[model samples]
Target chain A: MKYGIVVFPSKTLQDLANSYRKRYDPHYALIPPHLTLQEAFETDIDADKLTNIISEIAKKYEPFQLEVHKVSSFQPINNTIYFKVKMNDVLQNLHEDFQQQLPCEESKHPFVPHVTIAQKLSNDEHSDVYGSLRMLGVEHSEVVDRFHLVYQLENGSWTVYETFRLGKD
Target chain B: MKYGIVVFPSKTLQDLANSYRKRYDPHYALIPPHLTLQEAFETDIDADKLTNIISEIAKKYEPFQLEVHKVSSFQPINNTIYFKVKMNDVLQNLHEDFQQQLPCEESKHPFVPHVTIAQKLSNDEHSDVYGSLRMLGVEHSEVVDRFHLVYQLENGSWTVYETFRLGKD
Candidate 1:
């Protein structure tokens, strides 16, 4: 359990989470899409523990672009559709803000932003998501200047933990 | 559909969409989050139609804060999230742009500007999403400039369609 901004968009991400809720837990409400200013740490980690981490990371960053996306699935096999932001330097640096606050030696994969489309699904559901996506192919790209903090509950759905926008991307 | 522009900070949105591809639909991915000049029409559409609608709406806007949130969701229902530009004169004007474009016979809904996060969730799958949301609770807000245009495909994901940034907001 680490602390960082989990970027998701407005109603779209919430709706995706809702899809999971409708299917599985029945309690998976979502926050908003955003980036983090903290780094990876364990669960329930307090913000007090992160002050130093955030400062250290911020000290190094001047605000860079947090790439907007990377299409992926909740699970490869079950493959529910989902799109998320790229964890570029700006995003990583923003996460570093929280990561630096954590105590030394935390074991966790680094954070990358993502908008979950559904809970884990098997073959048939996977193809349905893919089918929908196949039609919406990429036409262009844009910029993101904000970061958000999010948390995952036992149900495995993510909620808005926090959000911070940079002065510049 | 009524149209409006949801402005993202910068490249952060672009990267998010890029990352979304890694796990979701790798083929045609989402374009970056941006200001949209058109709405989700009630019927087929194109840029000419959108521009005509937007040009008029643009005049009504006096410029205001389009607070960028982390993400908003559409799912189990839509399985998606997006950044909501805090409703303002700008958003209203954008929406007004499209409203004017609609044929007198067309029905319209309130227009809003925000980015998409996820989509395509069947009902039975996301029943629990309600309670799942409180977890995300917002943490940050950002001020942004510019409106981006993006479109979602039959697949139900979005890509940057175009961008129109206006005076400070």
Candidate 2:
């Protein structure tokens, strides 16, 4: 199975992202609004082992605030738009810690904590959306209490395999 | 054994880092100046297995240019100074691919590709050096042809276990 790890945004943020995503993204219905921590990799790791690894790391991190700062694009490189995450030591540490626990390959992309908005657009479509999203550089903060481990089903949609809570709360 | 993956800077860059590192860092004499891709992790995997994994991944990447742009610090979090890497898709992809191949735990810090100038400084010392380094930023670019897998000896110093070249070059 192919698996990835992510922290879904809060309800309010999810609703906000959903609005923009539904209009702009083709995969909006395929997955919820999320900031990917680790890109997907092929793994046969059992659920129990996955649960234990995530659970152990979860205990070390208390729920923290995540601020979505602005919209950015991978322009000239790829046709993807994302929400720029405010880089914080706590968040960086959380990513690093979880990465250590998982029994799969780590992503090579420099960890840019972001919720991808739209991808696979025509060049014209990307330019159009990029302009529209510039006005969407709003600041939204949320208390991140949990992260999910998800896997791609045969239908090409992703489903949550497990949820790891932050801290003891 | 404990292992790490890194790309050693070119000869000229190595000398440049070595000069600054020797004066500021205590570990300069202990290890060469190199950019770490993976921090040391304990593993029982044999060298042949490690080589095979790395070799397979290397074939997917063609040699690319890497630019070491400026100086940055982990101050207020940790006492370390590094050359801020210019984030690019190729380098990011390389890191993500190599990470997936290794059998070990990942680090708890976001991967910032840098040549360390100094570490283990007191807070005040870190402040002084950070100020000095801001004006000392120098841009250097080099073609990245290969990366090395190294292991720490019983004496706490690291040695190369294997070298994996990118593409056929």
Candidate 3:
């Protein structure tokens, strides 16, 4: 089965991300707005065993603050527009932990935690949206206490198979 | 350090358990009413590694129903009066998983998942309370989705070090 790990932002953040995604993101309907923890990957491993490993990973860390400070875009590399989440040690450790432990390939991209609001745009449209969004900016922050292991359905929409809560009991 | 794994029942159940515990359970104040998954055991293992292992375990299963249906006592076995929790494959599997994975001594007693309402009673007192409570017959059920890794504090109260949510993602 194909699976991925992600942290869905708060509803407020999701609504804001969706506001931009409705017009700009083609993938808006395919998956909820989220910060990709581990990119989607193929795995033939036993579902029970995979769930066990992820559960253990979730128990070690406390909830951490996530800050989305500004609108940003991967203009030069790609036309991906995103809410740039500020990096911190806790978030970095979580990403690395998932990378090191999960039975998946290393991500081709560097660990940049983001909520992509727009992607796959032509240069002119990218510039138009990115320019205005950057000017408007954005500032949202919330405590992230849980993450999900999601699977793609036959229909191509992603559905959560499990949710792991973070921190001490 | 010494650690244990347990599931704290809902407040409705806890409140019910505490009612009997106030009069019968000597260890009532030391910890909240809980179903012990793994008994307290000393460990020299690195905390982070232990946490990682536990997180993996938590992800493997979904929330399961717990039905506490009657007051029972371990007579001739030690006079441990408890709210007998009916056994199910999910709960049994959870207990066995912890036993097989965690660095702890093998339990001397067979696994009988329960919430102790009272313990350490005299032969006569145990029979008296057990008889009355059995006649009263408590019934409560809830879906338990998470468990805790807890440690004992210097004050003798147990506190949660981490909480692991069960199921995928």
Off by over 4 Å in 2: A1-169
Residue B91's lDDT within candidate 2 is 70
Q: Where is model 1 more than 4 Å wrong at Cα?
A: A1-4, A8-28, A33-45, A63-70, A74-80, A95-113, A138-142, A150-163, A167-169, B1-169
Error of 3 at B97 (Å): 1.1
At residue A159, what lDDT does model 1 achieve?
A: 28
Model 3 agreement with the true structure over B55-113: per-residue lDDT tens digits: 88888889999998888887878999999999988788888888899899999999999
Q: Estimate TM-scores for all models.
A: 0.37, 0.49, 0.52
* Tens digit per residue, CA lDDT, model 3, A1-169: 7798888776567768878887999976567678998889888886558878887887888899999899998879899999999998777888888889888898888898899999999999999999999999999989888787766544355545556778833
lDDT of each: 0.44, 0.74, 0.81
In candidate 1, how many Å is residue B105 off? 31
Model 1: lDDT to the true structure: 0.44
lDDT per residue for candidate 1 within A2-27, as digits (tens), equals 44444334334444444443453222
Candidate 2 i-RMS (Å)? 23.2
Instruction: Please report the candidate that would top lDDT against the real structure.
Output: 3
Q: Lowest summed-lDDT stretch of 10 residues in model 2 chain A? A: A153-162
Give the best candidate by DockQ: 1
Candidate ranking under DockQ, highest first, comes to 1, 3, 2
